[model samples]
Target: MPAKKAANQPRKSMKIKKGDTVKVIAGTDKGAQGKVISVLREQQRVIVEGVNRVKKHTKVVDAGGRSGKSGGIITTEAPIHVSNVMLVEGDGVTRVGFRRDEVTKRRSDGSTYTAHRSVRVSRSTGEEI
Candidate 1:
């Protein structure tokens, strides 16, 4: 018999966004750092460039008689659990925090209004990420 894996925590807004550099903290690709290619919000997974590479054997597809697609073993990145990675700030990884700031917004009526927007911040340096 095999043991069951622990269930992931409830999904929340991910601090890491596409194009952000992150370092893998756990799993097979641990210690690897790369730019985030995509973020899977529902699944709580993130695909990082050059990390979690997997090979897929795809079959060729043909549509009608004019165009067709070539298929073969293709190497690509796979999604890694968000918890396994940390946001890279400056020369090291930093935990993400959120700060709400008041900002002036303009409406269609040409009136200005003050609004509070949430911004991601670096916990270590207390600076926006």
Candidate 2:
């Protein structure tokens, strides 16, 4: 029963990582692509550069604690749903798939080993990414 329960656990997290290139698949940013700048695991959101821009009101800093300093509006990138983005391939234009590599068998005296490898494949050209 324990073994079956362990297998039913939800996935660890999303496969996407920081600095990874991703393409927007949904929303107003559809077809837009950019490098992943940040990931919000708690909210399941990602902020891609130049993807979602929003205005922020922030207090302006004074150089010498002067009262003349004034606050102004600032524009910045906002977090977007992670589901809208897809991992981009090496070519920088297509999405890719991840696959585990097959392990090789080895025997010496009394030993067994297994190796795991993952690679991305371009969905457009059917080539390794």
Top model number, lDDT: 1
Which residue pairs clash within candidate 1? none
For model 2, the superposed segments whose C-alpha errors exceed 4 Å read: 1-11, 61-70, 90-98, 102-129
Assess each prediction's global lDDT (C-alpha) against the native.
0.93, 0.80
TM-scores of the candidates are: 0.84, 0.62
Question: Which lDDT value does model 1 have at 127?
Answer: 94
TM-score of 2: 0.62
Q: Which stretches of candidate 1 lie over 4 Å from their true place?
A: 1-11, 62-69
Q: What's the C-alpha lDDT at position 32 in model 2?
A: 90
lDDT of 2 by residue, 20-84 (tens): 88998899889898889999886789999889889999888774665767679988889998888
| Model 1 C-alpha lDDT per residue in residues 1-129, reported as the tens digit of each score | 998656785667888899999999999999999999999998889999999999999988765565667788999999999999999988999999999999999999999999999999999999987
Clashing pairs in 2: none
